[model samples]
Target: MISLQEENDLIDQILGGKQEAYARLVDNYKSYAYTIALKILNNRPEAEEAAQDGFIKAYQYLKSFNRKARFSTWLYRIIFNTAISYKRKNRVQMESIEHNDRGEESRESDLERSDKEVFIARAMEHLNEADRLAIQLYYIKEFSLDEVAEMMGQRVNTLKVRVHRARQRLADELTKILKEEALTL
Candidate 1:
């Protein structure tokens, strides 16, 4: 993790005409940005595009960034919003597990992995975007609740409620999916 002082120095350097300093920020946050984009866009190519565009946007608006928030939180908000915009403009179709008709063409391990992925994806689909993002930011990305709240522009108490409800919704969805799978078998 980049120290706060180091990040502040880099920000200052970037603001002072040192464009290369921005690359360090990108290096630090790109994976998380990509993950955020991927979860929202659900398409690798579009997610990559969104994440790159987010980094570009962040650099363009670097001078306006408020110092009170952690840089990762700020960058994450940009990436998340950019991905949502991309999703809106493109209206990408959600890839359903039903589309995987590859019967016996796959190996057992691959099938199991694909099934788990499908299960999680389908479960996530049941959630509203905010709830889904809250869960991802808190659990999958392992951000602190306080950080997630900041990124989401919500109070910590509100965020706790949101996360709890989102988890319950996910669990319900997973149970439903499991029942459907059992019936098929």
Candidate 2:
């Protein structure tokens, strides 16, 4: 992670006609931006496009970025908004395909973990979009509550409540799912 001073210097260089400085910023934030987009769009291709578009938009609007907030927070907000827009525009639901390339060393444990992941994913599907986003940003992405709130454009307290409620709902759903699975065993 770049220090705040370094980030500011890069922003200054970008604003002063040193366009290459922007690449550093993009490199620093691209994975995070793509993750945010993936969380929203759930499609790898669309998420990648949205992250790129967000970077372009950020570059275009860089001059207007007041130094009040961290550049990352600002850039992530742009990424989040861009991804949301893409999600709205593409209303068609697409399932994400993930490839597992683990060797045979831990197949049994991997299967157990995969089963748990499927159950948790099913429980996550029960959450409303906002709650799901809030929880994912706060927990899965390991963003601070304040950062997640700012990115989501919600008050910190509101986001905290959303996260709490979402966790409760997930727990309930998981328990129900486990019970059903147990009955079938």
Winner by lDDT: 2
Report lDDT per candidate: 0.83, 0.88
TM-score of each: 0.80, 0.87
In candidate 2, stretches whose alpha carbon ends up further than 4 angstroms from where it belongs are: 92-113
Q: In model 1, how large is the Cα lDDT of residue 87?
A: 83
Clashing pairs in 1: none
TM-score for candidate 2, please give it.
Answer: 0.87
- Candidate 2 overall lDDT versus native: 0.88
lDDT of 2 by residue, 118-171 (tens): 788779989999999999888745689999999999999999999999999999
Q: Report the C-alpha displacement of residue 155, candidate 1, in angstroms.
A: 3.6
- Write one digit per residue (lDDT tens) for candidate 1, span 24-84: 9899888888988887766678899999999999999988999987788898888878988
Candidate 1 lDDT score at position 44: 78
Question: Which regions of candidate 1 fall more than 4 Å away from where they truly are?
Answer: 92-115
Error of 2 at 139 (Å): 1.6
